[model samples]
Target: MNVSTASARVPEGWREVNRAMWDERVPVHVAGSFYDLDGFRTRRDDLRDFEKAEVGDVTGKSLLHLQCHIGTDTLSWIHHGAARVVGLDFSAPAVEAARALAADLGHGPERAAFVTGDVYDAAETVPEPSYDIVYTGLGALCWLPDIRRWAETAASLVKPGGFLYLAEFHPFTEALDDATGTRIVRDYFSRGAQVWDEPGTYADQDAVTVNNRSVEWQHTLGDVVSALAAAGLRIEFLHEHDVSLFPRFDNFEVRDGYHRFPEDHPRIPLIYSLKAAKS
Candidate 1:
């Protein structure tokens, strides 16, 4: 289901399509090997090394995770000593899964909360913002159509002197095809929605079969940085990496548990981390 244009608002008609697709993916992801719930039961920290390094320690802090699918990373923050944590997702099933995972992990509502709502409504829906850390990780921003509104909401959610941390697939990487990682299959700048209709979710491609359709927007590095700056957030640092946390392409190699390009492939930035503070 293709939308009229890429420049639509956050609660546009196409968002329903994306939401339905994500709702269907929740069950598949929960039972899939990609998440490895068994492994997570023992090895609690699911955050990537870059995320840890970029966001730093969350000990004794209040954290809010936006678009937190299933809450693995949100729970990881709790294990890392966050005093309070809240995870928000548009999909009710994902939120339910997250709450169940928290309970199974022995975390109670006093320590963790999961809310089901559109991220665009987070500023108003989430129990009073002003969290110590507002964290957003990879494979998130593409789902949203409005970066400026997202930046403003993230800034509003952060407490004074606190920061908004983002770790995401770089726009440059998004422009390349996942099969070869060399073909320019997507626009790098803001354009109309990139519509897709595939058979499965990214977590487990063959685990289930459904006509999974979604709409994504392409955003440049400039679009991201400028949005935050416009929202009255001070840019701390923007770091680009050649390695990604996932094997986005067929030729990617696993290094130290992370998926990176093979040595022979041309070096290109695959991911980016940005930290901005509310003044």
Candidate 2:
């Protein structure tokens, strides 16, 4: 929002514009069935199996989640045996919700904590200098414009022998047609701030809302991997999955606790996960 795009002059900063939209949607997301807050409180974890397998065990280890929206996934880490967990988000309302959820789950500050800050400032915003695991969940990277800055910030937060894990919607999906998602209509390597104005959040698209405009950027997998490797982290592995946690396309159907193209449709990588260790 800072830079003047050809289309519009958004005087508001990206953080301000995006955070406003997220802040307005925090309550809607929590109450909506998408998050399943009640089921989560009852000890049901929504973390995908692939994420658990790649991150391995967290027993007694410290973890930091950057851009950690409402901290649903952050609290889930504490339940999975993390010694302590810290969640950082740009939205004050999201952080408040996370703190309330932590309290509801009977976790004190030592065990569960949340901070309100920008992801680019994570190195200084987090409670500790470093953590055993620096995790970023799905849909996080697209919000960031500078991939290298984000990589450096996240890498700086990983302790020696620790790793930074990221699970995100594949940038490839962005290049496809929005409706059918089969034709490549957009530039694959385009790296610029994209402005979007939609009426509702992904959770409940039908629900009316204010603060509907948001700005985002696209960072390709190659760009992300190269940036992290340049930041002094050893790339462990990059795994692309055909499964999507949500209905990303009209043809997508639920299968094995995930959504994917139906039997008749060809599969494409809908998401990807990567692990880079700070050795």
Q: How well does model 2 score by local distance difference test? A: 0.88
Q: Which sections of candidate 2 miss by over 4 Å? A: 1-12
- Model 2 lDDT per residue over 66-111, tens place: 9999888998888889999999999999999999989998999889
Q: What's the residue-level lDDT of 30 in candidate 2?
A: 90
- Candidate no. 1 TM-score: 0.93
Quote the RMSD, in angstroms, for model 1: 2.5
Error of model 1, residue 183, in angstroms: 4.8
lDDT of 1 by residue, 1-279 (tens): 223334444435778888889888889988888888778878998998878888888899999999999999999998888999999999999999999999999999889999988898998777755799999988999888889999988899999989999999888976788787988976676456767777676787665656476788877899999999999999999998888877888888898788888888888988899999987
Clashes of each: 2, 0
- What is the Å distance of residue 75 in model 2 from its true position? 1.0
Clashes of 2: 0
Cα misplacement distance, residue 90 of candidate 2 (Å): 0.4
